[model samples]
Target: GNLPIKKVLIANNGMAATKSILSMRQWAYMELGDENAIKFVAMATAEDLKANAEFVRLADTFVEVPAGKNLNNYANVDVITRVAQEQGVDAVWPGWGHASENPKLPNTLKEMGIKFIGPPGPVMSVLGDKIAANILAQTAGVSSIPWSGSYGGPDDGPLQAELNDEGTIPDDIFEKATCRSVEEAVEAAKNIGYDNGIMIKASEGGGGKGIRFVDNEEDLKNAYIQVQNEVIGSPIFLMQLCKNARHIEVQIVGDEHGNAVALNGRDCSTQRRFQKIFEEGPPVIVPPETFQKMERAAQRLTQSIGYVGAGTVEYLFNADTGNYFFLELNPRLQVEHPVTEGVTGTNLPSTQLQVAMGIPLYNIPTIRKLYGKEDIYGTDPIDFLVDEYVPIDCHVIAARITAENPDEG
Candidate 1:
């Protein structure tokens, strides 16, 4: 175990990597006067160099790689290791995309004796598997959607199917099953009650990659096989598609020592076709107690898995009934983590580095400030513990989307 990380590599590209670089710069400025205290190296692709010229200049050093090479690729592993060894980088941080959730990269890095600034590979594997994530959530006492389905692993079985469309089932969210074949799935969809419609999801897909929606039995029959064809390497299952559910998630930080905390929550309800369009923290509408319950559940889930780093536990909230179900657990830095940072005044990126260096959860200064000492709760400014019952005194929102030029097409 390293005591404190010195040189670190920003092993990913895009805005997430840029944000991490900026966050690290800010943290270095405020905490450590020495600009070289924690050196940062970036893996720059041709596109990154073109798009993020500013970051290229800001990095302590960078190794140029080919364009379109994903961070999770094995080839990148050798590249990263060579650069790390050459530059004396003690750890690697995969911001939020590409290799962030890919367990293989972390496992490989660990074998090379380099710290991966996120959760362990086994933890990622469990959370990466949709069905395993569901079972973990339930074991952690979190309420998850009523689901049924099994992962057939490498060997495709009766339950196995493919997925299509733009939506993905976060490899960890299991599916419900009443039948096996397309005819059986259609019949089962009818028996399951499609008042809210039926949802077809891949057992091991995410990012809206393997999902299909059908409003009636006829639609279900027609789309069943086609939906399964969309996904590869996993089984698809059915579920009661929630028509009007608010997507809320709790931001969690955990350390190697088994302690964890829920910073706050975000409402990413403003989404289009399963992609989040906007997100805001301390959602304006949710009551206080309900929010507390979510925080508790999120902490419980992360701690249960010995999660180390910044991760998010998503939920489906029904405003009418005030009920929520655990949706999925994203075991890496989320794109919307800044929303939680804005509300909680937490330096998540820096904290993530500290955790990777073996810092315990409670010992983190921000955690102690937010969750005060046991003896002193409110009056102590230094040890001020954030009251779970009271929401943070700030609100933050984010909006970023991609669009095409119609005229060009």
Candidate 2:
């Protein structure tokens, strides 16, 4: 029954790794009695340490790991476990992206008696797979985005490019059938009333990489093949496109005992090419009642799967219909989490560590309270010393995404 976490290893790299390091540092300085009580360790490649020397400076210990050739292969379970075991770290937190949602990593770490700071492996396995997560959302009374169909390729040949069967999809949800072959794609497009338009998406894709919008028959054929080309060895599906839709999401945190709480909502409609560029908390576009509905649905889905730690539930909201559908659930810390934390006045890193260490959600941090009855500025504008929860009354936004220009190529 050892609950004191003296050391934590951040088994991640890049910006997420940097942010986690800073958050832990701030947490230690503000909450923990001793700033150096929680020894920090960052597992990075040689190049990573050289480029991000600041991480090396912030962390108490820096361990070298293989960066591999790409992001997916950068972080490995063996490397993380070896470092944790050698350095005597009590927990390992996978910063966002890369192997953050890998079920095997958590499963292996837990088996080794190391605390993996995130949801359980079984829960992650369910959420990581889009098809399983959608079905789970439906069962939890949360309306999921309508899709043409769902397909799982043969187990023996995972990358077999043969057309597969259309799984059981709800009548209201299913719009078109999947087109594994070029011929089937053409036939299915005509059958689904292609006048409006159809969207081709990879079942396992994220960050708007494998989504293609096709408005005509010719584009459908081209997009079908193009999508297959973009992402091979993955099942693809088609869905009807909702024009002028708003992208919104709800942030939720849960504990081991199945208690989940939703931290308001965020509107991330300002996106380019399906990638969000700007996000704000307490969505201004969604009505209050609808926002409450989204929060409830998100909590229902989170608790339904017995999810723990910090996660995000995304949705597609249509201002016309006043209806929203579950998009996906990110079962790890998200990039836009800071906006939620800013408004809620909660230290996410501290809460996440507490939850990972089996501390109840209610006991981790005190709810924020108003400093005075007047609405004016002063040295200390607000107070978080209250024992009960207080309503959130401000807006926080997150923006800026620096990237190289593809057109330059």
Candidate 3:
């Protein structure tokens, strides 16, 4: 990225974004050594902070992160700001969509004159809420699913999407996106207009945590009750179930100068119970034409909104007609960034920081012309090139790559 840096702070602790923090720290050190370049700090529970003694040691400082029992987030912006003020950090990178409306974080950090190393809070809020995301997708004309507000609660209001009541879900939906009122839910079921089956999602949540398929009215009714009970504390959600669908997503970036381009699209169909255990880029299906069309739609959304930074737009592929619908938008770096990195040869975090700091992308001529299918995926390609094997969503993977650190070496 060639981004000149002096200081950085990370606002979450998840193994998923472990590489982003460590790599940035190491890469910065290598580029600028320990003096004028930078240092890193991670905020999370004191217990979690203690667990990674070695990793914490690499950080210039460590701040005790406070969270509720669920660990739903590690966002105590007050504490983070104090540390940033004390340490004089130039930026705070919310790792992997970590601060999803922790409310106090963004405004506090902005007030302190420290940069939030992600997109604007408005963009994040627009994409974080599932229903809002669905609306954004429709407005952008992107392919994904339509989702109504949270469903399933005794005293709750009405629901607008479909519902099911046949009773047997392959798994269950109460776990993540909760539910709405039964009457509202029942009415929603009648409105669905599909014969095969319908989906019940937790409207107030995600992380692929709460979602289920109710094959019939009986299932939908039972699911409504179950989800309503489950989300008594947080709201449960519901949506238009896209069955036998191929889940796909594209990592998009826009700049202050009005440029929105896709890094690449990933096929997340190999998920079991909605948790994506495997993924690969340059979609297995969706010929070049379809891919480009999707990208154009996605870029239009980001461009229209003047979106900047690393964001992901998710879509659903309908097997019935091979059409994609807007599922939602992830207005932050995703877990699958490595797939895009392997293809684009670009540092997304650097791009995001630059853009957020009022830097334009036009100077980088390769912004949109990055990585064609010929450069990576294709038959009869480069004879001297090594073949690559990316995991398709299917099995248990507990693997690690071990290598000597170049700096140490």
Candidate 4:
């Protein structure tokens, strides 16, 4: 049931685009042979062309997007989709940033009969929203941090109804732990019993934005206000901050046929200002049993949501207590995915494209060995346990280098 996908549009720029294009070519050469190599279309702004960006140069062909601001080009769903349509692209690859997680992009591509190399629009919407994702994770039996909000209880009937109807949670559905006022936040903090501190988090927050740490009631109001101001109108929630916890994530891939597998994981605890600086696979700090539990939880969540494509299920592991809480599910290829690839020997970008082409995980040659089954088909029961089949052969770590202003430092 594979759909034809001869041409792909890399709807991003820079490293994300560069890596994806390279992987796609490598996958084509190895899997499809030289005569059937997939053609790639890379995008660039006027300024990028002037700089002679590496991705544009690597692509089989390049398209020009407007310069000035990203919204007019890279982040613009209209522009990206338009380019895809114009180029006769069979599939679109939104690497990590830009419009990767924006459900609008996928929804639009779905409508246009073009394949989106990630989760479906509805699945993306559910997982992209922190509040909805947390509730869904809880429903899927994934362990989550104690937090204030609708924990999929009887009181969340209205919210659940709305989600079922629209595939999204409305602003008015914020209940229990979600605080609109400072008073509600204080009560939530007290109820959660944060010995270390409580975090005021915006539901739409990511990459260290829209977050505030309050150690006591005295600072709670100000922190709450700051977070509210940062994300304006976004639902805010309170959660007990796990002190000295290691950041861990499970690399998961699901297919249209309901098959999902966990490809081990990485420890991304090395961070500065809430941004990961280093990442490594086969999280040795966490016990093997606990890590397996994470893998199972991750795979269960993926299958429950019917998510198709490459994704990362993140968690905060308290090594001392051997307890871990689900953080979030990033519904697209992650920037730090190379660490998992290094250990698992899987090319995530190529896998994503294959999944988009209606190929099941059991059929994907790069991942088929992990399942240890020769005749797994679309009609078979979905059970591919990573611990039973996949072995972590090596440990690999990645360090990120960033340029910063000396004055700011």
Candidate 5:
């Protein structure tokens, strides 16, 4: 496992998380330092024209990837990978949040004798898929919205029936179906009150754009339709409409040797328009017993699947019913990963670089003592949105800059 994969190209758009880019660049630049040997670049798609140019100017190297943003289909995979190979990029980093749609890109990179940074292709696929994410959590017996990674056809129709409009779902009901229609979605949303009123959502590339919490039919219709185009336009939609509850997430680092350990859990209950405005660590509602339970669950899944690099196991809570369910797995670096960094006082991305270099996570200890403590979830623990989208622009750390259009950059 000699993973000396330096020079990673972070393939994403300008509209991507500015904070995430900053954090990763901070580490990548430091890793390179004055060596100037290997370069970690942020490759911008056609859509991310302005930001990509600005980013390249701010950081070190940049690539104006002409790759299409409409899901890495036949042409995009080869296009971006070709850019990497042509540019002599050592590895490709798809940024934080989830895996790449071009599953072939990783293998293609490997075959071309280049390294694919972040999680391995298969591991990323499993964790990225909602249905597969649930299956990963099964060995841990972690509760989630009860989901399948993708939607099924006729066989799924009956399960879909259970969520009839205005109808109620019994607590004992297992086996849930993925819904797309506005009507079925509304019924599922209304059932949230009884089911603790929560839902889980995952999308292809738009990581923070898909989640929605609907207390009733109206909310469901509004949210479902709003996100439907993005959902249906793609090959698959990893969405779960369930109860609104506690936001529990555990971050981990694994290696090819199959060592996985929880970095601790963070509660991000406060969010707006799907963006986590505030986040804290140690999980308040999830004390020692639940924290350990969640941690062990995540570790087992990671080992069973031979997952490597950083990943997160998300969960939804029904505080009223006191029931928490496993949500979805984020297969890449997270936007809120910094809070976990702030809490642990550890450089997660640096540790990730080590893992990318074939380092095992055995040196990292489990958070058993952290569980025994009060499990402080972190600071700034609330979503700052009452109405109107604020974006991260308002934050001090965030700098606002105007950029020219696509070709202008």
Candidate 6:
């Protein structure tokens, strides 16, 4: 049931685009050979074309997209999808940015009969919403931090009506619904306890944007207002923050045939603000048993959701007490995925494309070798593939560099 993918559209720019194009070529050459190699189509803006970007030069062909708007050219779903159809692209690979996590892009591509090299639109929507993801994690038997609000409550229920009518939560419904008012947040915070502090989070927030911390009830109102204003109309929720924790994530890939495997993990603890600046693989700080538990939890969650393609399951690990809580699931290839790739020796971008082409996990070359079984019949592949500990080949670390304008600050 393999889908024929002769050409792919790289729907991103800069490093993401370059890496994706190279991975596609390398995978095609190494696996398929010269004549059957996949061709890549890269997009460029007028500015990019003027500068002769590396990805444009690397691709087999290029398409020019409109420039100078609020959203980047690659982020425009209509333009990207239209270009894909016109170019006869068999698949679209959104490499971790632009429209990578936007369900609209994939939904549009699906409607157009072009393959999306990521999870389906509905799956992306579920994982993109923090509340829904948390609920999914808990349902998959993954551990999560305690929080208030009825997870997955109806949008048009009494809670929504109350928020629409008065812009506040009734005291009676404070414990069972998301906080629409400062008073309700404060109440939820008190119930959840403020020992480690409370995090006011926007369910739709990402990249460290719509979050605020309050150590006491006195600062709760201002923090709540700040987050609400920052991400307007996003549902806000309260959770007990885990103090002195390390950010650890498991690299996982699932396929359409209900098979998944954990490709070890990375420790992304070092950060500036909430953004990770340094990342390393095989989080040695945590006990091996703890790491295995995390891998198992991640596999269970991935299988439970029927996730297809590469994704990261992040967790906050308290090394002091050996406890961890599910933070969130990033439903796309992460920027720091190379660290896991280094230790695990897997090309994730290529794997994503293969999964999109209806390739099962057991049929994937790297996964098949790692599973180390001649025949996978009569075994639950999820458990059979990941139950044995696969030692990381080596340790690797990555540091992100950024340049900021001093004058702007």
- The top-ranked prediction according to TM-score is 4
* Minimal lDDT window, size 10, model 2: 155-164
Between candidates 3 and 5, the TM-score winner: 3
Best by lDDT: 4
CA lDDT of every candidate: 0.72, 0.72, 0.59, 0.84, 0.55, 0.81
Kindly indicate the candidate among 2 and 3 with the higher TM-score: 2
> Mind sharing the TM-score for model 3?
0.74
Model 1 spans with C-alpha error above 4 angstroms: 50-52, 69-82, 149-180, 187-191, 372-391, 405-409
lDDT of 2 by residue, 48-128 (tens): 766766666778878877655534234566767788889888898887877788788888888888898899888887687
In what order do the candidates fall by TM-score, top score first?
Answer: 4, 6, 1, 2, 3, 5
Per-residue alpha-carbon lDDT of model 5 for 1-409, expressed as tens digits? 3767657666654433344346555655654554344455655555556434555544356666554534452236676687788878777766542235445667688788777666666666545555445644654455545333223233432222121232222223222434546665554444333243434353442546555554455665666666665555432223345445677888876777756767766888876645566677757666555666677777776666667778787877666666666777776767667667666554665666567777555432222223332322232211111111111111111122433366788
Cα displacement (angstroms), candidate 6, residue 12, comes to: 0.2
What is the clash count of model 1? 22
Candidate 1 weakest lDDT stretch, 10 residues: 160-169
Model 5 scores worst on lDDT over the 10 consecutive residues at 384-393
Better of 1 and 2 by lDDT: 1
lDDT of 6 by residue, 303-384 (tens): 8777898999999999999999998988899999889778877888988988999977766776655555565332334354
Lowest-scoring 10 consecutive residues by lDDT in candidate 4? Answer: 152-161
> Model 5 Cα displacement at 304 (Å)?
1.6
In candidate 2, which residue pairs get closer than 3 Å at backbone N, Cα or C atoms, i.e. clash? none
lDDT pick, better of 1 and 4: 4
Candidate 4: pairs in clash: 148-177, 149-177
Cα RMSD, model 3: 10.5
